[model samples]
Target: MVQKTFGIYTTTDTTAEEERLYVELGQRHIALWTAEETTRQILAFELFEHEMSPLDSLAEVLKQVKLFSRLLDNRYAKTQVIWENQECLLVPNSFHDREIAPNYLDLMFGNSVNTLVQEQQRPAEQMTAVFRIPRNWKDAAQQYFPGAAFEHKYLQLYYRFSNDPKGIYTLFYRSHFILILVKGFKVQLLQTFDYQTPEDALYHILNTCNQYKMDYDTTPVHVEGLIDLNSPMYEELKKYLRDVSTAEPSGEWQIGSEFAQHPPHYFLPFFKMMS
Candidate 1:
């Protein structure tokens, strides 16, 4: 069963024509947000969680997408969809070649016949993100929101944290988490790992630090997404890292009281994309 895990609708007075829609499609979650363009205030936010069995067919996934799209207002002034998945990699612009983009993924993830390869260039960061999305999901997204822009989730993170100090930044999801190591304004590592327990998550973070020679005793670590301050993962991280904290929400956007229902850091990347 698909469940609306979290929702906050603050306004119905504004027409869809005056709002912008942002949808984040991930492995197990669908989050939608609407904002008033003029005021730049978020009007509504909804998060849905679903489980997909290995036996499920492509049609089943498309059906879930259709059901989730109902919460999206098709008449919005503009819409952008952010695709979040594990099949992506970032390459420095100097070494990036558009014609051979598929080869990069093929070498990293082996050949996949059922996916569409795409790329996004970040001129400022001097990097290009090459990613693959399942063709069925891509077709469904195109059908639901024709002409809408699409972006990989890591591109947003790179834009948000590329300028920050040298540290390890992690964003947790249901079964997987993304870890980024940045130093000297350059990304050293940007990868995702699947974990079944808090120990598994800690092992990956610490192992990455060791591999990169980052001193866990001194290097800062900022975590966000679905993790909580009191959760075992947070406590475990604090035990090993000297400086660990939850990433703060950007002060630019004016969030309403409705957003207060959840921890400010829960949707850090989602809100950062608004800017």
Candidate 2:
């Protein structure tokens, strides 16, 4: 049997050993790997520092994520889109049991597109594009939003960006939940919270569900991040959000993992204001 495999490399967590552990856990599904470079070093700044533009920042991050997805789809064993951020990842699957297919990713960053692309045998669009956004941002996310009205509009989303290399500290704002609409693609809604305690975050999330009138409390939602499951944040998140399913956090796409894998990889090119 040809067991499918995929890899993640990022710097969300500073721990190096956790990568191997995450990989081991993932081995039940897809074979995992990591890059020697840290994803933290790839910092993108706004086009101009003239004003505080959170929306612009969010758009920039989306672009970066989209570009990264493009690169991943351009090359890979499986022609599928991959999405990553400091907190989690989401992969599209053709099978009912999404985990069985190597169609999604966890956290990991910092390998050249050229290298990853070299491994691709198919063209883009043959695979589904992965889309992920801040779950905590849904809370207190009104500031970056634009209103959209649709009957049974079950979801919402917002986007923002910043120069802060420390992605977590940039404010997930779990107090509010917002929805994002893609022209002809998919829609995303997320909740953001301040406290590191997962219980607190989960409480806020539940509240949002009530407000949205969606039955999410018992739903098995998926999540991902780079922090060790044994850590305070991880434990808290699991306890409070236990009802939801979570993906293995991608260390390969995060800053901490990137640094652990490679401290000196050049990331200046990837982090830039696209014209």
Candidate 3:
């Protein structure tokens, strides 16, 4: 059974015509958000958690959730779906070839016979993100949201952080976290690592810095998602790194009042996608 762990439905009326929907799908959770089209204010949001057996597919899990069904019933002006997984590669536009996009993942994560491969180009960054989604999951999303656009989560983060000053950016999930190293308007490293403890997370961050010759004493580290300022992970980071802080929201949208209950950084990436 799918459980809604966190949610905020500011308005009961779901028939608004000027609303846009954004969804993010991960292995253990699914999150949906609705925003007003004209004002770009977040209206409603929900996060659902589910445990899948080895044989269970994402499509089947989505069909079993009631909130998903109700949300899908609403008509929206636009819908954007973000897929979150570790099977993604960022290739420079100068060296990218669509004909061999699948080969990139194949070499990195091995071949998967039951996945749909797709690519998103970032013209400004001169890079392309090649990724794969489960075939059944893609079909299920298309069946319900016929015109919804799809993209990988890393691509969205790349658009937001690729040009920032030299820093280490990290976004945490339940069992895994994404680490990005950016310097001089370019991404030096982007990869996901699984962790079982705060020590594990710190090891990867420090190790990455060491491998890339980044100074832990001077370089800044910014973190968001699923981490709290008081959490052990945050403390672990601050103990060794000179400047560590939680990332703040973009401040571009009018966030609903209910969102104040949670830390601003918790949903930083989701809000950034609306921009």
Candidate 4:
């Protein structure tokens, strides 16, 4: 798999943000750029940075994004923003089996009604994903990007990959990793973990495999995101699996020439959003 060194990228460019649609907001870094509204293809994109903390208001991130995005034009005219936060919960859509509990997340996170919580139901998939954007963040989004869509990053990847997965699929982010186990379109497991070292990440994947009775030695694994093909994490994974390869974004939008420069997997969720 190839690794995209996103940290080397800049925040946002003024004239460029005007031409396209959709932005990825993660870790106080705003990927502000445009995709063709008709084609939903990425035209040009740029990343913007602002200092932030878990406790800092998300408005700080929005403030910096507004400083760059709303310079002389209004993105709200046609463009939309997609927020990618990690805090989320997924519940199967078996209403008869379990009562829907929206407040369950608030207690888990120790936030109250002040949190901006939203849920999307993929009834065809029998799952409802509830995700959170900090209140300050939601307020900021509503102000500048009223048409914004909020989803947990994991859910975005989950729906896209789970539709027709085989063996194991993993998505590696800079901060953590997510795993989804599927056998012939049947999802057996969905999970996430935080890791500081390569071994920590390995342990979670291997342990999950063992628990699910997956043959770690033979199950083909597909992966995407910030992992390097020769990195210790990838090498260690290769030792356990018979086949491992970097996965490409599965759906379609007319890909722009500018997108050719970035790893295709880096924009998997963004493409999924547009699709």
Candidate 5:
């Protein structure tokens, strides 16, 4: 196995009685960070390898989350986790309180056995965001934030990129994580795929576009995260999509100037605030 880097970013002299935390949990890695409760501002962030597989890593990931929160002096704060499992769906908001409310994910992913499902309503529109969280994740989330919202990563991302004009917004992030979002007032498609080569990644992009019947030459493709102006992925994307370009996190949170140590588009630190 190869050893990769772990990171923590923060600002000192915090004074909140209880901080707020946001998490993005997945098979490859986990990200946890504290956010200002009212302003939705990011206070600190941490990233570490979780070595995820199809098998569950809830125990290990939450352990790391607690360790990082303690390091930031917010071990028992109000928390919300964004499960990046990518097994998700977005249904009509009207169905949220109906019979399908609890079974929306089961209906989509077809896992019949009882699972804890969570819902986030998109107030700006009449859409409901529904998804499955492993029972393990539901338990840990209850321990962390008993009465608050627990969500899926794509749900939060959907709200962030929901304003895009009927096209694709992709995040080629760290650890082979690709978040492909197709939005037009509502999310038409949202999937996370892992790729090993430039060809492999582009194939998925083109395939998704073709499947959706979105014109790559006309529909703008906005790229972000680990990719850059000189990357093979960027160059290849430009070859197929007419309006390919770098994208950034949408928020008013303060980013430390020292974060300049990394690429400007690398906003893993700010992602937690999307929830």
Candidate 6:
């Protein structure tokens, strides 16, 4: 089957119903993201082009604007045109200049800044992931929770492992543990720890989780690391966390999604808030 993709970026919650509207209009699966609650930031839209060209998908998107507008009015209790092509979509740039500086751009444009000044400015766009869940999971989601929402972020970690030539070497000798918070379809935090023992490493992990304001009451804690899965250090971490069940590889860091560049930018606002 051929899948068509389109992205909707809006200042308010107007684009929230675009996905269902498109699906009703004979459009295949579409991935959507919103920035409604983020303080100064407005919105970001990502459209994936798979089994079709970008131009055809773009046309299909243009054709569905009125239906999307009506859906937004009936569902989210708002009436507005939520889709704009040139405003939300970003043009490729080969310039090595300051346009690539995220921190500076975010300072000027993120949710913290006054939205009224640039209410006309559209949020930037990028290509992002669209998941195909297992059939059982999909059936459960549709049956019990039809109108539910799920949000996720992506992060990258860099670790260095030390090896020894001795017969009995140490497992926790030289590895830097990192935790990243992915938000707005980008990495927001990158925390690193240099601990001496497995206990210390585990402590750092727990402390980092404590510092992060996750939905712990309902959402599960997730950890990803580059360690020998069968090593003693891994066993100690499992024991320290009270069970080996919670200590597992992160699904986000699977084979296909490996980082292709040096590293990602840091989200300063989240850190200041964390501090």
Highest-scoring model, lDDT? 3
Q: Candidate 3: deviation at residue 165, Å?
A: 1.0
- Runs with alpha carbons beyond 4 Å of true place in candidate 5: 1-6, 36-41, 64-77, 95-114, 144-148, 175-186, 249-251, 268-272
lDDT winner between 4 and 6, please give it: 4
Assess each prediction's global lDDT (C-alpha) against the native.
0.81, 0.27, 0.82, 0.63, 0.63, 0.30
lDDT of 1 by residue, 6-25 (tens): 67878447877888888887
Write one digit per residue (lDDT tens) for candidate 6, span 1-275.
23333333443443443322211111122323223332423243333322322224333443344244322233331112221111121112332123333333344334322111111211232222111222332343234324543211111010111111111101121344434443333333444355667777767656654665432233233333235556666787656554232232222211111222211111111111110
lDDT tens string, model 4, 137-201? 76766776666655555555567667675777776767566677887777766666778788888
Of 1 and 3, the candidate ahead on TM-score is 3
With a 3 Å backbone cut-off (N, CA, C), the pairs that clash in candidate 1 are none
Cα lDDT for residue 175, candidate 5: 46
Instruction: Please give, for residues 177-218, the per-residue lDDT of candidate 3 as tens digits.
Output: 989999888788888898999999999999999998999998
TM-score of each: 0.92, 0.27, 0.93, 0.77, 0.79, 0.26
Residue-by-residue lDDT tens digits, candidate 5, 52-165:
454464665666556644433445346666667666777766556656565655566676444566666767767776666667766765665566656666656766666666
Each candidate's clash count: 0, 66, 0, 6, 1, 8
Compared with the true structure, what per-residue lDDT tens digits does model 2 show for residues 1-275? 12221123443433342221101111011112322232323211111111212222333333333343312222122111112122222222332233432223232332222111101111222223232333322221222222311111011111121111211111121222112212212323332334546565556656655664545544444333233335565466456544543333233343444234422222211111110
Ranking by TM-score: 3, 1, 5, 4, 2, 6
For candidate 1, the C-alpha RMSD (Å) to the true structure equals 2.2
Off by over 4 Å in 3: 12-15, 53-55, 67-70
For lDDT, candidate 3 versus 5, the one ahead is 3
Residue 183 of model 3, lDDT score: 86
Backbone clash pairs for candidate 3 read none
Provide C-alpha RMSD values for all models, in order: 2.2, 18.6, 2.0, 5.1, 3.6, 19.0
Clashing pairs for model 6 are 39-111, 40-110, 40-111, 40-112, 41-110, 41-111, 153-182, 154-182
